[model samples]
Target: MSDGIIGLIGIVALLTLLLLRLPVAFAMFIVGFLGLWIVDGWNVAAGLLSSETFTLASKPELVVIPLFILMGNVASASGMSRQLYDAAYSLIGHVRGGLASATIIGCGGFAALSGSSVASALTMGKVSLKEMERFKYDDRLSTGSVAAGGTLGILIPPSTGFVIYAILTEQSIGRLFMAGILPGILLLMVFVLTVLILCLIQPSFGPPGPKTSFSEKRRALVGALPILVLVLVTIGGIYRGFFSPEEAAGVGAGLAILYGLFTRSLSFSALKEAITDSVVTTATVMLILIAAHLLNPFFALTHITETVGNFLAYLDLSVLGTLLFILAVYLVLGCFLEGFAMLVLTLPIFFPVVLELGIDPIWFGVLVVLTLEMGLISPPVGINVFIVKSVAPRVPLGQIFRGVIPFWLAMVATLGVLIAFPQISLFLPNTMFN
Candidate 1:
């Protein structure tokens, strides 16, 4: 059989394995290893397995993953995330739907620290859900806002999603980080706007929270000051070329630990737990990357990327049409597959087509990450919705799904805006790097 046909069979088998509840890393590893063995030989496959594992494990760039994860874990353990939420609540909690808006702002800030949607959702859900319940906010709006806002984690700077995308496409992590900034802010605004409109239409959905005195606002802001400063230092240092992404991550992680210790908010046991969580999360990401590297070579041997490129060419679609087509596929795949798995599985096939079409990789990376965010709240496999459900066990799963729909539509609108004006995604990176 042709290599292309063999590759196609391998992909089908991989999907079957995933559908059967096999882990993403193992499924990719199995498919990639067997594809290599079939097309090349056992010796070549074994050689690659060892080399790829070592190469990814020892890479300096991957160090950012663990460091940023640790920063997030430490922040969560230390009540930094709670401080951020309180600061946001004090400033805006008095307005109609302000509480939900504050939750989104908190999620965005925590996303900067954590670069994890699950972490953002879980931490914020724990912090805000009960408070919202106390204030009699509708569970749908409360749960939905947390689920949707948490997705900001992947689009903001220090994002693990961007790091993986950068590695896969051989793009600059700093540039991708810069590219995400404006788009992340734009999405945050869109979500807040959605909440405002929802509350306007149905005032009972999110009641106006109590107004805080100026002193209270100041105190809450003071509590959150350390995290704000840390975010500025790490991200600003990268923008000014004073620190590489890796350096920034290490600094952020170190600062997070110091703040936790100084405030006595992070006990020894909590610190240890944070480290363990970071290690486990980092290991999962690394295994996926190594598996992707192995799978990439198999796809290359079969010339699947080239074949896919040709098929796109045969369609005679304009650049925008092709781009939209690819994004549409992502939206569909997102319903069934986890975001990272979908990313690794498809980028090798689709990214070359993007490069061939001369689309800017940084802009495309932002767009792809945004689409992944939508998937996190999309139905059936809405992972963030599930995360929110876990935190608010009393809320029905269906209610959480319903709550996310408006925000999900808001995401669709935000996606359109980003696509219409690619400059939003490119402006920061272009201005900084150029």
Candidate 2:
């Protein structure tokens, strides 16, 4: 049989394994190893396994993963996430639907620090859910805002989603980071507008909060200053070329540790837990990256990317139609697979097709990440929905899903805007680097 046919069979088997509840890393590894053995030999497969693991581990860019994760874990353990929520609450809580709006804003801020959708959702959920409940906000508004907002984690600068995309596609990490900024802010605004429109139409869904006195607002802002500084320094330093992403992550993690110590918010045990959590998260990401490397070689051997590129060329669709078709596939996969899994699985096939169509890689990266954000809130496998559900267990799972529907539509709208104006995603990267 042709190696391309073997590659097709391998993909089918990988999907079956995923459906059978096998871990994504393991499934990819198994398929990749076997495919390599078939295309080359057992020796080549064995050699690749060791070399790829070590290469991925030793890469400097990979260090950013653990450091940024530690920064987030320390931030969470130090109660900074709470402070962020409080600051947002103090400023905007009095407005109609303001609390939900604050939750979305807070999630955006925490997302900058955490670079993780799950962490952003979980941290914001724990910090804001009770406050919204106390104010008698509708379960849909309260939970939906948190679930939708958490997706900002992947779109914002310093995002793990962008990092992985950069790694997988051999693109510039800094450029990708820059690319996400404007689009991230745009999506955040869309989410806030969605909340405003929802509350404007039905005031009962979100009642106005009590206005904070100036002094109280001042205090809240002051309390959150440290985290704000950390985010600015890390992201800004990268923008100014003062630090690489890995350096920024190290500095951010160190600052997080110092902030926790100064405030005494993190006890010895809590610090340990933060480190452990960072290690665990980093290990999982590393394994996925390594597995992707294994699978990449298999695709190269089988010319799967070239095959798909040819098929796409044969279709002769306009650029917009072709991009939409790729996005539709992502949307469909979002219903069944986790965001990261879908990313690793599809990028190999679609990325080449994108290049053949003369699309910008960084622009496409932002677009793909946005689609992954939608998946995080999409039904059936909406990871953020479940994360919010865990924090607000009394709310029905269906209710949280119902809540995210408006935000999901907002995501679709944001995707449309980005597509129509690629400049939104490309502007920062082009201007800043140029």
Best-performing candidate as measured by TM-score: 1
Off by over 4 Å in 2: none
Write one digit per residue (lDDT tens) for candidate 1, span 1-434. 99999998988998899888799999999999999999999998999999998987887888999999999999999999999999999999999889999999999999999999999999999999999999999999999999999999999989999999998889999999999999999999999999999999999999999999999999999999999899999998899888999999999999999999998999999999999999999989998999999998999998888888999899999999999999999999889889999999999999989988899999999999999999999979899999999999999999999999999999999999999999999888887734
- Say which candidate scores most in lDDT: 1
Candidate 2, residues 1-434, lDDT tens digits: the string is 99899989998998899888798999999999999999999999999999999988888888888999999999999999999999999999999999999999999999989999999999999999999999999999999999999999999978999999989999988889989999999999999999999999999999999999999999999999998899989998888888899899999999999999988998999999999999999889888889999998998899898888888778888998899999999999998888888889999999988987899999999999999999999989899999999999999999999999999999999999999999988877787634
lDDT of candidate 2? 0.92
Q: All candidates' TM-scores?
A: 0.99, 0.98
lDDT of each: 0.94, 0.92
